[model samples]
Target: MPETGRREPGAPANVPAARPADDPRPSAPPELDYNGRRHRRAMDDATLWDMARRIPTALAQTARLAWSVDRRMTATILVCQVLSGLGTAVMLTAVSRALPHLTASDARTGLTQAWPALTVAVAAMATGSGMWILADWATRRLNPKIASAADLTLVDLHMKAELSAYDTEGFTDRSQAAEIGAMRAVDLADDAKTLTGGFVQLVSAATVLTSLHPLLLGVLVLSVLPRGLGGVIAARIDYRVHDRTISARNVRGMMRWWLTTSELADELRANTMRPYLQSWYRAMCDRVEGRELEGARPYLLVTLLAASLSGLFTLGMWVSLAALAVSGAMSTAIAGTAIVASQTAGRALNSIVRYGAVMFHHGLYLSDYHTFIGEVRSSATARGTTRAPAPRRIRLCGAGFTYPGRDEPALHPVTLTLERGEIVALVGENGAGKSTLIRMITGLTVPTAGSVRWDDTDLATADAESAWRHVGLVPQKNGHWPLRVRENITLGQPREHGDEGVWDAAGRVGMTEALERLPDGLDTLLARSVWGGHELSGGQWQRLACARAMYREPAVLVLDEPTSEMDARGEHLIFRELRAMARDRITVVVTHRLDNVRMADRVIVLDQGRVREQGTFDDLVATEGSLLGELYALAQDR
Candidate 1:
């Protein structure tokens, strides 16, 4: 009694309804769901020991990256950091040796005796300052190089990945995370340097404290441990908040792009969508801000407790030092020196706590970068070594394709042959597998079942790059490159014959007259956003896309809804050119315009991913009750 696959009354048919876990139909990938799961796992698994372990690993990785970019600069920075630490120790030692002389009862004698020690102290101070300057100079030059290298590596990985990888589950989420990691790579050098500097300072100051008194070193650790623990706790909380709010932040970014982008400005105002989008953006912002505030509460509380404990310990340490002086167990000069060492040690401890936490946080993102690169490299497309010659015939033997995570195939197994110098046209309704079949024929997608071959070379075994040299395709949605018309037509590969070939192709597509009207002719930039650039109308852009494909002079030419936006005259001119060009190339056209099929040598009608009819155009029109005839009659009446 009820219609199959129907929803209940009052349900909107176009809007997607929730499906059961076992549903056979395909659904859009849940991008945020994947992001949340992976990010949560990474954050939740991090423990105190794990954080400690990750710090050195992160520093080593940063060092390796810096070394690869510029080894001389990296070595200079390392030597500067090490020498700076030694300079601090020498300066403190000189000051300690000068204390007794400077404090002697005879003022003139104290000045004379302390002169050499004071001179040594001044020179050590200058050396430390000079090393800081050198390190800073080298870092400024190296950080940009590191960031550029990271960005290039990410782009290279993206170029190598198979086209199908983009549609795979979790791939997009991993890519976004990897991009964040790549951007943070610029911070890696600073984080590592700060961490290294802190550790050096701690070691130098601790050695000075030990020389003064072994018990003083113990007091120093007691005073600083609470603060270090607090920093680690706060970092953990911050990472959790960041992981949880990533999805919401990504949504806000998308909303912001839609609101500000020039391409959508007109439609946004025309449809009065600004307020709706603004409200959506504000909601996501509030969600992220709420999570941050929640995280901040615990962080503030931990820092407060840590600071209170540290203050008490510092007071006790000062009291102990004064008692040692008063009890005559140490001299007044030694006590004063100990005071200076304590202050230096305190500052060094603070640096260690602060920079260590930062390095740990950055390490989490760096992990994402390494994971994504490995995954992409392992899954990169493998083009066979067998070189393929130019195709004379293309054949598909029972080729079918089913998308990832779907039970039903997008296209049924198809058996067909296309010969050079023959023009074939495909007719179909929406979602009738026409585009899928075209992609299979063009080698853009590999079939899940069966094989596609060019001459005797199977696409699965032949070299993809070599086989692609003879194919040219124009899809329904063509790219609008912001380049000069000449470069756009040639796709940056200029022919040896130059503008003569460009003009010939433009004339065939009826674009030569329009191009000639421009101030720079073929040199005109097709981006209105750029200075001195020109823009073309929808029909003119379509004509340009057609001309680009024709310029290739490919052995196989495939056009999908190529003239959808063109006027009657422009459309007629393109079909006439196609008829002439079909004499040498294997041309396949996908169009819903029934009138255009009259120019095709053979017409194949598709319905629900299966071939329903195939014959010459005149023969199909003459047949009684044929699907093509019925579709043509309906179009004529409209």
Candidate 2:
């Protein structure tokens, strides 16, 4: 029978209907489809000449980084490189000078005359070898230090970036690329050294070859040009693959984390999700592998063509040298010296091509690092000079927030005031703007429209650091830090009161007994057993989070679903403590547990990003057609 389908009730007409079981159309893997839609900004193709032109800039940047890390090592490496080049030059010159005498008909007399030149040749060779050893020693020590510095810089940048940057599109991908670039900083340094050494060797060999016959220098250039072109092409292909597969690779990493992490272990097995997740992982792997293999095809072809052309040019070069020697246009000794110089020059050229390609590849990543750093710096929050004191009142005047790339605001403009010595309950369904409202009240996010003021001070123009000092927040999803029990409670900021303050906060959340039962009391590490630490149950962790907030004892306290993980007794104890603590500070609690609203001094009900009702719990519950009353009655029935 011919397939037919009808759109589900209220379904958008534009939505496509499902295909039949025997449909012949092929479907792309989800990962591949996602990868295709991403906006890739990979490095573009460049000619060998373009790469050669940019080499000096990359070398200079590497030099500056090396000098900044350790000037003494940089100077030592530079001096050794120059001396090594000079040694090669002197050795070649000495050999050329002694060749004729050593090959003369009266070999004994010729040998006697050649001893001085031979001695110089041996000394130059020894000097070159010594310099190489010293340079290698310095490089081994210096490269690690350079890499460490790069990583530190990147980490510091990440720490200072604004919280909103993490939510921005493409930000995570950029950060990953920057991290890769930072890790390869040492490789760039090593490549710079190789490039410098290759240039010196090329120069030394070219000078000797030119002295023998100018035509040999031309032949040397022709012999290596093909390889250089091939290298540049290969580098472009590699970067293109890297750029295109970033999203797929990142997805694979996330899936691996999901599969391996303890947080999802029980649920994964209970839901029988391993096979599905593994299949997704394998799909991503296959896609990445296919991309890599496809990228390698052109590189292999280029390498073959380059090698073949290079072989032809090299044979012609040797044939020309032999012709000159046989025609007596050059002496046998000069011809023999030319052979050694040609080989040296050829190797130097090959090194330049190989290292230059690798260096350029690393440079692309380095550019990503620099670009991300610049972006982070630009997006970083600018702290105002005005200091903010502990506020007695927080006022939101027509405040609203719209996230990036979205037309509708997550929070609608609604004027509200929260004053000292009041406990306000924010009651709302999911996506009713309760969390967004609390974030605004705490000054965690700046309002895109209108203003938020702490007393008389506008948060937008106040020092964020100073303002945050007065705010204590227990978010819906709290951090599970792998630190000591005491450190977790204090959040690494131990006050002068120390354990006294920690214990007081723990007591308020009824966590003192739980903490005391641990093997090391307050000193016990809070991590999984495999890590030589003890993990806490979900409720215990929630108590720890509440204690952390209580320890701060700030002027403004915000709790979002803080008691969701606790039992009835534990939840009652938390609310009783919050009421007692609310006498001196402003406390805002966001919860769906409508029964808890009776303890609040005032209740604010939100629906669809707007305040729908406001009053005491008794008054709202008594009123007719009240959203809070309706919600509370529904909760009672459930």
Candidate 3:
């Protein structure tokens, strides 16, 4: 197939563009410099202007990230912040108007006196203060709601992702990064509304101050520049620190999981590796700090120097205002207004600096997150609506598939078929595309070429869930749910965990003995953490999984070494039960155990993704000139 941008007739509508990892360019990094000196990257002035112009758009983009939770909360918070700012402006003017008249000797304005103005000024401050407090409160409350939304979204993404997506090695790294970043991004997005309000208030205050006296307004605005620049500079340093610290952070997060979780508890205690893990953790912490200090010290030093300069500049502006007041160039009221305006501007500047730093880091991770999300949504949407038919037999015509990171195709283009109501065995060594073929057969991965047809319907043309309804796969690893024994057995047939079906499924695999040992029989919890719960042996878990496939009763059952953990008696029992169940369904069992293979109605020998031979058990041995015959001789010797 050519690398055409368009989807084919049956391909998903939004088949994601498969980007090569080696692409030289990722997104452009921030312009802020590090190493105690500026290192200007190749960004044009127009680009700077464009990004500056996009600040409002970026703020709006930030707002959209939280809009799913409560649009009203975000709007209300911004409104409150703006209202406070507007009130501050009016109050400054009212008080500035009154102070000059207070010092005059019977030279009061005809409209009003100093006292009335002072009262209005106080009232305005009180109102503005209330609005500010309200905005802050709203911002804090939004965090959990936004975080919850993202958590649920991530869970859905992970669950909905097609099984084939995991074929790539990089998926693990990206998934870990996405999981941590998505949580962080949601948290930051929640506070974005407050930042928006604060910015609105800051601009509003500046506008009012400029009207008072453009000169004083300009000087006040300049007072915030150093800190704003300092913050951006500091953020770039943090980014550099992050690159060096990833290994340590990865180690720390891993250690925390191992020590705290039940998943690793058995291995940790059995191996007695606690001391080694603890030592590794201590080393990680030291390295984390060392990596940080390499770039952070210079950044901190520069930040302090710039902050000191900004503070001195602010003091000078105040002094200039006071001198002008003494000379009667400006009234006492206007002078007071200047002082208030300067304070407002200074706070506004601090906010920009603080938020700029946050946005920079957030933006970096967000870029990666957006890329992943784009692919997921595209894949989900592309699957479209699937509807498949129950075909009498499945056909594979030159079907091919390759794992994302693997060099060779997992399943080379080879055709095979299993007629209805037959037990077909797939015998091959590991990595011979047996499991991969099963996954493709189960509709977890679409073929890269050719097609899988169920009688008349093409399986690839249908969506995963719809196509999978007629198929059941018990993977090589026992995929047992940590729920009740009955629930685990009835996974594929939730509603039909009907009383009779549950009993039938349980009774078939000899799980009755295990069920009776539990406090509540079939309803007993399989995981230890649940109340009155009990654990099952490895063989017991495998039987329960088999019962699930039986309950579903899908037309096609692909059991990849389903009895790997079962003992001799259990294996014989399960195979006999399967033979009873296969009267009206096609059963494909992949196994290495020749004893089990003998029971299969037909054995298909696969070596390196190609069918080497196929025949009944006795017939293959009778040939006396193949891999099957050679294997049997070795088995008899053993």
Question: TM per model?
Answer: 0.85, 0.85, 0.83
TM-score for predicted model 1 compared with the true structure = 0.85
RMSD of each: 7.5, 5.7, 11.1
Clashing pairs in 3: none
Q: Write the per-residue lDDT of candidate 1 for residues 354-406, one digit (tens) a residue.
A: 77767766677678888898888886657687777667898999998887877
Off by over 4 Å in 2: 1-44, 49-57, 108-112, 167-169, 230-259, 263-305
Candidate 2 lowest-lDDT run of ten:
24-33
Candidate order (TM-score): 1, 2, 3
Candidate 3, 1-638: lDDT as tens digits: 12223334775443433335774322211122232211122112123344355455546555676676877777777788778887787787787777777767675452357878888888888988898888777767766787777667767887787666766566666665566657775567544654565576678667776787777667776677776667666655666677546645755787787787777889998998776666556656766777787886888797898789788887887788888888988766777777777677667766765665455445544555666666666555146455777667888888888777778887788788879888998887777788777776766777887888778777776766777788777887876577887778767666554668887887888877778778888777777844547788888888888888888888998888888899888888989988888878889999888778888899988778777889898899789677787887787888
408, model 3: CA deviation in Å?
Answer: 3.8
lDDT of 3: 0.71
- lDDT scores of the candidates, listed in order: 0.82, 0.82, 0.71
Better of 2 and 3 by lDDT: 2
- In the range 323-432, model 2's lDDT, one tens digit per residue, is 88889888777777777776777677777877886676666677778889899988665657788888899999999987766788888998999999999999989999
What is the number of residue pairs that collide in model 3?
0
